[model samples]
Target chain A: MILQVAKSFILESIRNTGVFLGNLLPAFIFIICSWICTISIKSSPETLDFMIKGQFFPISIMLLVFAFAFSSATIYLADLKANNTIHLLKRTNISPAKYFLGIGLGVFLMMNFVLLLLLAGYSFIISLSISALISIILICNFVLLAIYPLCFIVAGIVKNGKVAQSLLVPIMLVFMFSITMTSLFLTINEQQPQDYYIYLIWNPMLYLSDTLQFQLNLNDHTWLPLYQYSIILTILCMVLSIFAKQIYIRQD
Target chain B: MLILDKVQKSYQNHSVLNGISSTFQYGHCYLLLGDNGAGKSTLLKCIAGDEKVDHGSIRGNEHEDVSNLVALQYQFFESYSFLKVKEVIQLFTKLIANPSNIKDLYELLDIAQYEKTLIKNTSGGQRKALSLYLAFLMSKPIVLLDEPFADLDLKKKKQLFGFLQNQVHLQNKCLIIISHEIKGLESLFDFVYIMQDGQFIEHGTTEELVEKYKNPTFSGLEAVYFEVTGQLLGGRIK
Candidate 1:
C-alpha cells in the first residue's frame, strides 16, 4: 500500500500536467537564468569564483524553496484533506506512516531530480574540479534536506489546496527573503566585525550557506565550524521531518 | 455485522450523535432516512470512524478492522482534482488490492467517456458515479452511503441502486445508506431507521415498519415521515 501510494504520486505527477510543469520549469529556468547571468562574468576564473560564492549559492537556495513548495502545492491540489483520497485511504487501511512515507518519497524524488539538473548544468557551464562539483552537490542536497520538510509540514497544515495555492507564492517569497537575509547578514558580519556573529548562529540557513561557502573555498575560514554545523543542521532537519510526518498523519 | 454502544459526537456544544446504539448485520440493507441537519451524516461518519466519538465504542465483526470492513461514501466527497478519472480508478484498485479486473466498474458506471478527463472538470453527477464506483471497488463487508442518491439523475440513480443491490445480494455486505429519498430501494431494505434530532426516532424491518406506519393511500417510504414524524421531507426535498 505504501508503495502504491508512492507510485500513485508519480502517476499523479504525470497525469497532472500542471504539477510536472510547475516542478520541471523552475529547475530548468533557474539553471538557464543563472547561466545567462554568469556568462558575461566568466572572463576570469576569479570572476566566476566571486559570482558563485556571492550569488549562486543563495540563488540555488531560493530556487530550492520554490521547487519544494511548488511540488507540495501541486500535491495538495488534490485536496486530500477535504477530498475523497484521505477518506479512501482511511477505508483502505493504509496506515498514516505508509501514506506519508509515500508522499515524502515523492517530494524527495522531484526535489532531488531538480538538484541533479542544477548539478549537471553547473558542471557543464563552469570549469570545476571533480571535487568541487561533488562538494556543491552535497551542499545543495543538504540545503534541500534542511528546507523541504518545512514545505511538507506547511502544506499539510494548510486547510485545503486552494488555500495552499493562494499562499505558496507568498510562502516561497518569505522563504527566499528569510534565507537571503541570513546569507546577507553573515556576509555583512564577516566584512565588518565579530560583534553579531554569535547571534546569527540561530539561523539554520546560516549553517547551510556557511558550509556551502566553506565547500566552494569561497570563505578562507568558515565563521562557524563547518563539520559541527553540518551535523547539527542535519540532525535538526531529521527531527523536523519526523515531526512533520507525525502532524501529517493526524491531519489525514 | 457491526455494533455501536452509546456513540456520542458533538460540534462544540450542540450534539450531533446522542447515544446512537444499534446493531447491523450482514446480508441486510439499512436505510437511515432523515431531514437536512438531522445528524444523519455525522452518525454515519462516526460509524465509519471518520470522526471520533466523544464516548462510545464501535465493534465490527470479530477479527475485523472496522475501517477496513466498511467503506463510507460521504455525501459531498471531493475527488482528486489533479487525477484523471481512469488514474483514480486504477489507484483505488491498488489501495484495496482488488484482484478483480477493472472492467466491471467501467461497465456499471459507463464512465469511459470521462476516463481521461480530469476529475475537476467532471460534472456533479459524474463525480458521484465515480465515488460510488470507487466504493464498489473496495468490496468491503460494510458499505456506508451518505446521500449517495444526491446529484444523480434518475437513470443514473437506477443504475447505481442496481449495482448496489447486486453488491448486497452477491457479497452479503452490510449496506447502510443515509438519503432523503428511499423510493426505489424501499422494497429491498431489510431494516429502516428514521433519524430525527440526533437519534433514531423509529426503526424496524421493512414489513414491520410498513405495517405500523405505512399510509393506506401511499405506497412508498416517502409517506413514512408524514405518518410517523408529521413533517414534509424537511422543506422541499429534491
Candidate 2:
C-alpha cells in the first residue's frame, strides 16, 4: 500500500511540469552559482583554496535540502489536502499514517536523488573520496529526516497550495540568509570559540554545515561530537513528528 | 447494513448535523434531497468517516472499520489534476484490493475516450464521470454519492441512473445518493430523504410519500417534496 501511494505521487510529480521543475531548480542554481564562483576565484589560488575548504558547497547542499522540504514537499502535500485528494483517499480505507509515510518516502527519494547529482557535480570541483561522498550523502539523508515533518506541519496549517506557495519565498529567504551568515562565521572563526557557540546553538543549519565539514576533513573545530549531533537531530525529528501527526490528524 | 444513531456534528458553533439517526439497508437506493447547507454532504462525510461526529455513533454490520464498508464519491473532483485519467485509475486500482474491472468501468462511465487526458484538461462533466468511476471502482457494500449527476448532460444522467438502478437490484449494493436532479429519475430510487436545517424532514419510499402528499397543483416526488418541505424540488417557494 505504501509503495503504491509513493508510486502514484512520483508519477504525478513527474507529470506536473511545475513540480518537476521545482525539484530540479535547486540543483541548476547550485551549478550556475558554482560556475560563477569558480570564474571569479581563478584570480587568487589562496582564496580559491579557502572557498573549497570553507562551508561553501556543504551550505549549498543544506539549502537544497531546505528548498526541497519547504517548497516541493510542502506544496504537494498542501495540494493534496486543498484539492480533496486526502479526503478521497480517506474514503478508500487507506490509513493516514500510510498516506503520510508514502508521501514522505516519495519526497525523501526524490530529494536524495537530486542531492546525489549535486554531490556528483561537486566532486569534480574538489576531490572527494568514495567514503567522503557516502558520508555526505548520509548527512543529507539525516538532515532531510529532521526537516520532513515541517512539511506536514506547514501543509496542515495552510488553507491550500496557493498559500503554501506564497509562504515559501519569504521563509526560504530568511533561512538562506541565516545559513549563509553561519557558514561565513564558521569559515572565519575556525578555532570554534565557546563564546560564539552559544549564539549558533539554535541553528540546525550550523549543525549540518559543521557535520559536513567534519565529514570532509575540511575542519576539525566541531563544538559537539558527530554522535551528539545525530542525537540532537533525532530528538528534534521525534518532537516534530509528534506535532506534525497531531496537526495533520486534526485537519478534516 | 449500516446504522447511524443520533449522529451529531458541528463546525465551530454551527451545527451541521443535528442528531441524524437512520438505517441504510442492502439492495436499496436511497436519495437524499436538500437545499444548500442542509447537511446532506455532511451526513455522507460522517458515514464515510471523513468527518468525526461530535455526538453519537455510526456502524457497519459487516466490518469494524467504516471505510471498509462504505465508498464515497466526493462532490469535488478537482484533486489529482496532474495525473492522466489512466494513471489515476491505475493508482487507485493498485491501492485497492480486488477492484472491479477497469475496462468495464471506463466504458460504463464513457470516460475511455479521455483515458490519456490530464484531469485538469477534462471537462466538468468528464471530471464528474471520472469521480463516479473511481467511487464504484472498489466493490464496497455501501456507496455514498454526493451530487453524482451534477455536471452531466441529460443523456448521461439518464444512463447513469439506469446503471445505478442495475447496480442496486442486481449486485445488491446499498447506494445513498445526494442530488437535486430528481425531475425524470424519480422511479430509480427506493427511498427519498428530505433534509432541512440539519435534520430529516421526511423519509419514505417515493410511492408512499407521493401518495400521502398528493396534490393537483404539483406532481410525483416534486409534489411530495413541496407538501412535506414546503419548497420546490430544486428551488425555494415564492
TM-score of each: 0.85, 0.90
Q: In model 2, which regions exceed 4 Å deviation?
A: A52-56, A166-179, A186-204, A215-217, A225-228, B62-67, B215-217
What is the lDDT, from 0 to 100, of the residue A212 in candidate 2?
71
Angstrom error at residue A58, model 2: 2.8
* Model 1 lDDT on a 0 to 1 scale: 0.69
Tens digits of per-residue lDDT, candidate 1, B43-158, equal: 87777777878998888767365765777775654766767888787777776755335366567577898898887788876787777776667767788887777876788778
Q: lDDT per model, in order?
A: 0.69, 0.79
Top model number, TM-score? 2
lDDT for each residue of candidate 2 in A1-80, tens digit (9 for 90 to 100): 88877877777777888768866776467666666777787778766645654646765686688876557788888888
Q: Which pairs of residues clash in candidate 1, taking residues 3 or more apart in a chain or in different chains?
A: none
Give fnat of each prediction, in order. Answer: 0.59, 0.63
